[model samples]
Target: MTRLILPLLAAAMLALPASAQQAPTTPALNLQQNMLLRCSAAFALGQRLQQAGAPEAAGWPPLAAGGREFFVRSSAQLMDEAQLSREQIVTLLTRASQDLAREGQLARVMPVCLQVAGIR
Candidate 1:
């Protein structure tokens, strides 16, 4: 998965559209959404670290536990604040992640990714 992340990042960067750097079409995420996004990235990056057998990841069992908590709260927020069913939320997340991955394909995002994960 760690190996895949590098190639995925490269391919995603190359596939970015010229307009991806423009402002978003939708409203900003609410507070819950903000937490969800951070936790989601942390969880994903943490998992990638673990999969690569990083020694520090052993300290992150609590991270997985925290992910479950976030998932629960985020799940509830999906229905209440977002008025989205779980399946719809899943679709939206998949699409949004894909979009982010694509925007990440843009050169503008590479330096940030490299700084964060040495993936460039």
Candidate 2:
């Protein structure tokens, strides 16, 4: 047992520096940047759908859905890395939803969030 213990500890110690020396991953974009990108992408996607001739109502849904998925993903990341609160994330998502809803692709952008989520 004593022999096994020393070897294990020695191995662990040796591994630590190598692990540390491995450059950490470049930091991910923060919540705001991610949200901006997601919202913009959603808008672009929505515009494409509109141009493809989807009804205004139907087109909005997919964009909103895509946007929400991104929001959820961003919230999880913010919580994990930055310790942001759920409320803050919610507020951010809400504001983003409103902003995206107002884009020119939308005609009567009422309650677009559910529509986006409902998209496959």
Candidate 3:
């Protein structure tokens, strides 16, 4: 399970930028920003799960790392693709952090994370 999930996580990270680049303009899904937000939530949730000693936490480190990298890379892509300034990215991230914090536990956020990463 660990082996399988790790590869899926890595592949999701790699695929994110390409998928964002190819996303149609004016689509309902804001893929780039949504990915960043979901990954941020996932990172936070992973930390909490690890602290609680959940068995599923075994994959948290890698998922969190990949999510972080994906967040950084995707935010850059958002800058170029959406013409958003660095200030805007920071603001958006801050908002995402706050919103996710209010959104409760790992169970609530995990599905969004998986969806954003295109893992499910």
When summed lDDT is taken over every stretch of 10 residues in candidate 1, the lowest stretch is: 104-113
- Residue 116's lDDT within candidate 3 is 64
lDDT of 3 by residue, 67-120 (tens): 555566776777777777554454455445556656355557666676666542
Taking all chains together, each candidate's TM-score versus the true structure is: 0.43, 0.36, 0.51
At residue 90, give the lDDT of candidate 3.
47
Candidate 2 per-residue lDDT over residues 51-80, each given as its tens digit = 467676463444434544554464577667
**Model 2 steric clash pairs:** 61-115, 61-116, 64-116, 65-116, 65-117
Candidate 2's C-alpha lDDT?
A: 0.46
In model 3, which regions exceed 4 Å deviation? 1-32, 44-61, 103-106, 118-120
Cα deviation at 99, candidate 1, in Å, is 18
Off by over 4 Å in 1: 1-10, 62-120
Residue 11 Cα positional deviation in candidate 2, in Å, after optimal superposition: 53
Worst 10 residues of 3 by lDDT: 1-10
lDDT of 3: 0.55
Candidate 2: residue 36 lDDT (0-100)? 47
In model 2, the runs with Cα more than 4 Å from the true position are 1-32, 36-54, 57-70, 105-120
Which scores greater on TM-score, model 1 or model 2? Answer: 1
Clashing residue pairs, backbone N/CA/C < 3 A, model 3: none
